[model samples]
Target: MERVRITDDGFTTLFSTEFNQYYHSVRGALDETQRVYIELGLLAKMQETNEINILEIGFGTGLNALVTALEAQKNNLTVQYTTLEPFPISEEDVSSLNYQTGAETDLLQKLHHVKWHENIEISPNFSLQKVNCTLQEFKTSQLFDVVYYDAFAPSSQPELWTVETFTHVASFLKKGGFLTTYCSKTVVRRAMEQAGFKVEKHIGIWGKREVVRAIKL
Candidate 1:
């Protein structure tokens, strides 16, 4: 069973007793999502086009997907999001989250309740396909405009941050597509470069110094 805890900021995060890790920083879950993935990854791409396709590596808590959906709705942009997660949280645990408090809460619930492996339209402009698989097992020929590489740190799950792993994911991105993550480790950045990404560093969210944004060129 997965153990979870609510942060001081009132957002829920998964605690991996096995890994001795938390799915997100205790500083603020929503803040980190907005800063790293939504603002840097999605919004940056949104500036280039009105429509976007996004691939997410770790779909823990479905927070990134929900925030992306809300941002797309706000900007009136079309989004096609595909996410991979080998272990999904239970519906009961999802229901207990206090992430969203208003009309957005319904949208968040819809995101969790929707069927996996099928592209389901969550709203007029946001469509999602949740794949229940690991990154190595995920296979698709479709290309994406953005990727949210929110995997666990290399210290805990080093294999996921390797050149081989990034090469696999980069194969699915269109030229100029961007992959953003909260991880800014030099080895990870080098791995992304080895995978053919033109990598750049950006200011990270609170408590973290830097993050990475890599471009498929």
Candidate 2:
């Protein structure tokens, strides 16, 4: 896939035609991640728990992972984060996506050099493991506390949005655990319901009308 830079909401955003839309926007993309997904959903759940184990479906641009790590650092929350990326981007490509001005270069380096295939502690409370494999092939013996289902739009990769794959993911989520997605399609909502999740429509960000947040019941 080819990456192109575009200006969206005052931020220089990067996107691949393979995945629709911009990577992020200055005005609202980061806000969407921080407010809707992280704050209202993920962090809210973590507040009631002593520790959290997060599984991210698509580690695109490493934005969600970074935010999670930063939150763990700030809140002294213990986190075990596992991220999956089938078509992982190169280090240079990730570096180019750091459009946020004044961001520490060390975070970028840490992001690029993080060990893959094994759990590595980046801090006392934050540990990360990257699996360089597609979702269909990965195997896990543990259930997660939360899941960030940030795959490409359903139209771009329908297979990942199917009930079958979601069922597979459900096997790895503890009872009462939550999964958040930026998609609100009928098929996707139905798939989550079929996978035994209690699905609900959530407030969307960045000019979006709706999103989906589900809890495994």
Candidate 3:
């Protein structure tokens, strides 16, 4: 099994024989998760729905999950989250994540060490379950309101970002559900479009000029 090492920007970096490019970079990691997944995608969906169910791909270091949970509490929204990670970091590796200090400290700790593979209730408004399995094999009976497609870049993990995988995810979304990703590749955009999604380009953070977001109709 490969190990996840911490990056200077306080994020985890995993090297998979599968995807190659350091998995994640801390400097841009939180920005991407918070901006694209939590703020823009998940929180936006909560405005109209009382209960929001979110599915996140590549649950690296639990950053996205943690952000979503905290956002739910702060915004007075109820969220049930499920994440799929094929190669999860060990608990000790998670503890090593250098999360930001001050107001983010307590939640950072909880997010770092929350038990894996079980539906753990982190707060009144938030609960999460993680599956340490490949995305290809993970299945759920329930449809979701939001999907955070936080996989590696298409240049790294082509299969995860491919049309086949997204098509599978598309089937799991309820009408009008949205999937947000940091990829802006034309091939990926085309893939999302072919998967029965209405694709749109959105401005991205962290020097990322553009990102692709898809809605299932």
After superposition, the stretches of candidate 1 with alpha carbons farther than 4 Å from their true spots are none
Q: Over the stretch 110-191, how does candidate 2's per-residue lDDT look in tens digits? A: 7657877889888787888999898999899988989888877777788899889999999999998888887888988999
Compare the candidates by TM-score and give the number of the best one: 1
lDDT of 1 by residue, 45-153 (tens): 9889999999999887889999898889989999999999888888877876777758665877888888989999999989999999999999998999999998888
Backbone clashes in model 1, listed as residue pairs: none
- The 10-residue segment of model 1 with minimum total lDDT is 1-10
Backbone clashes (count) for model 3: 0
Task: Report the candidate with higher TM-score, 1 versus 3.
Answer: 1
Q: Candidate 3's residue-wise lDDT over 104-200, tens digit each?
A: 6777567556667788888899888878788899888889899998887877777887789889998889889989987778889888888889998
Q: Is candidate 2 or candidate 3 better by TM-score?
A: 2
Off by over 4 Å in 2: 1-12, 24-27, 99-104, 206-208
Lowest lDDT sum, 10 consecutive residues, model 2, at 4-13
lDDT for 201 in candidate 2 is 88
The whole-model C-alpha lDDT of candidate 1 against the native structure comes to 0.88
Using lDDT, give the best candidate's number. Answer: 1
Model 3: CA > 4 A from native: 1-18, 25-27, 104-109, 112-116, 206-208
Residue 174 in model 2: lDDT? 91
- CA-lDDT, candidates in order: 0.88, 0.77, 0.78
Ranking of predictions according to TM-score: 1, 2, 3
